[model samples]
Target: MNLLFKKKDTTMKTIFLLLLILIALNIQLTNAQPTSKYHAKLVALDNVYEGDVDLNLYGQNPSLVKMEWTEISPDSTKKTIHRVQYDMEAVLSFIIDKDTFYVKNLVDDEEKVRPYYLVRKVYGNDIVALYQYTSKEGVKRIYIGLPRRDPYYVQHPFFTDGTNMYTAFVYFKDCDALYQKMKAEQDGYWFKKGATDEQCVSIWKRIIDEYMNCKK
Candidate 1:
């Protein structure tokens, strides 16, 4: 009986040690996580459009895409103008096969990022689609921010192949978490559907300006 009692005591001690460790880890995560200054994140889309396709025929998404910056700033100022510049390119192909598309979504093959962000262009609150797609199949398979019910795998996915191909690079933080943020904050932006190259550069200029002015 004494032996059994000692064994039980040992097990209890081990369990207690584990619980303490878990609590410490949880506390670390809470403290270490990055915080944005603004309670209200400004959700915006800056478009760099590729070629358009007819839905009557199925194919991959186009090559040579564009990117825009959306911010959730701490300050509340309407119509603040800032400039950003995106001047990086890489050697890789963004292609689609029939209904499926493969989007690296990076400037080049060599660059690396942690894929810390997600962009969901919504027709409305209920409607969300990723950047690439097949017109006939619609956005049924290829979307980043779809609300999945039981199978949580459907939400905030990267490098997922389906009706559309979604891609991500290295981000400063976790990819899925960043994606969840963009999906949740659903705010409208100055979306330029098919702006000219010059217009697009101008938009980047605004981003650079804002990014510099904003506190890191």
Candidate 2:
């Protein structure tokens, strides 16, 4: 009888331990999955939509796919969900996870024109800095948008070859004193050999901030 009781106790303990292990594994699996749905607000040429949306922005055929939810009953108990594919050309902007993206026609070095989403980094009185992730290059490309001039790519201080550096400074020429100051401080600003992307972006933002302050 003593031996039987010991076996039963051990079996119960083993079952409890197994249950804990199963629960831990389930939690790990749930946390490992990427987010598939998000609440988003999109602005179009004539309409605005706000609801749960699924983004497929990195695939071969990138798109802004939105899932809209509507109340179907007076009590707001019944809801209907529908899928919509937004016309990329007609979309002006969108907000997701508190980040705003603007639709812009981006032209590449090869003169290829395509619509891409740009997130504003710095908006000053005279110029605005915008950036977008280039999945093919696995890096972010920054651009300067000026009045009456098409937005052009600017070299990432640490990532690129600095081919556009001259053009970028030229655009800043309107702010003559600030441009000269930035030109003189160019080496100190972005010449770090091994700075990270975030560091480079910070430096660029500081430069723009200085420009804005000087203009005022």
Candidate 3:
């Protein structure tokens, strides 16, 4: 009886060791995967909310954006992440040069001409789009109109410019499926249950880094 009990104990210990090794290998494999090539960061003007009006269009707020640009994939298959921090206000405004792009407020059918809450900024050769994140009424909500393409425009839009502004269209349209997938992966370790806004942003940056770095 004593010998049988000892053998059972040894078998359990061996099984536990193997499980640990397997877990380690899985983690290693996950971290060693591949990512995409097109990535850019707007590093200079993070907290400069009150800078020159031309420079900071989405006043008194900060946001981070990430995008996956792929031609072979469908537009819906691409991903964009926008994380923002700002005061709780009903509407936000912005301005763009006439040559850049035209944004119409579909709510009013009026062209966005004044310094009201618009999401994208286009200057010399670059475009920046902002998305204000909210979780009170729902999960990850922001609003903006699509850019009106200019035939004479020279610079192509960065993925951040084109995709980040369309948060509802790009993300929340299928948010339920995404949320479920994010929750199931790594037992929701990246942005765990009941995560704070800052924590969620951090997780987004981590995900972007992994995607950009070609990691699984």
For every candidate in turn, the CA RMSD to the true structure comes to: 22.2, 14.7, 24.3
RMSD in Å for model 3: 24.3
Tens-digit per-residue lDDT, 91-152, candidate 2: 76668877776666665556555554444444444355645545434666655555555455
Per-residue lDDT of 169 in model 1: 16
lDDT string, candidate 1, 1-216, tens digits: 999999999999999999999999997666442322211112123423222222112322222223333444567554433333222122122222322222223111123321211222312122122332333456332232233211111222222222121222122113344334323432221223443334423432343333334323
Per-residue lDDT of 1-216 in model 3, one digit per residue for the tens? 999999999999999999999999998676442322222222223341211122222222222222223343355776544443333122233223332212213221132222222233322112112233223354432222223421111111211233322332233223444444444453332333444445544444443333334322
For model 2, give the 10-residue run with minimal summed lDDT.
56-65
Badly placed stretches (over 4 Å) of model 3 are: 1-184, 187-190
Best by lDDT: 2
- State in Å the error of residue 90, model 2: 3.7
Among these predictions, the greatest TM-score belongs to 2
Which run of 10 residues does model 3 get worst, by summed lDDT?
Answer: 150-159
Q: List per-prediction Cα lDDT, in the order shown.
A: 0.31, 0.60, 0.33
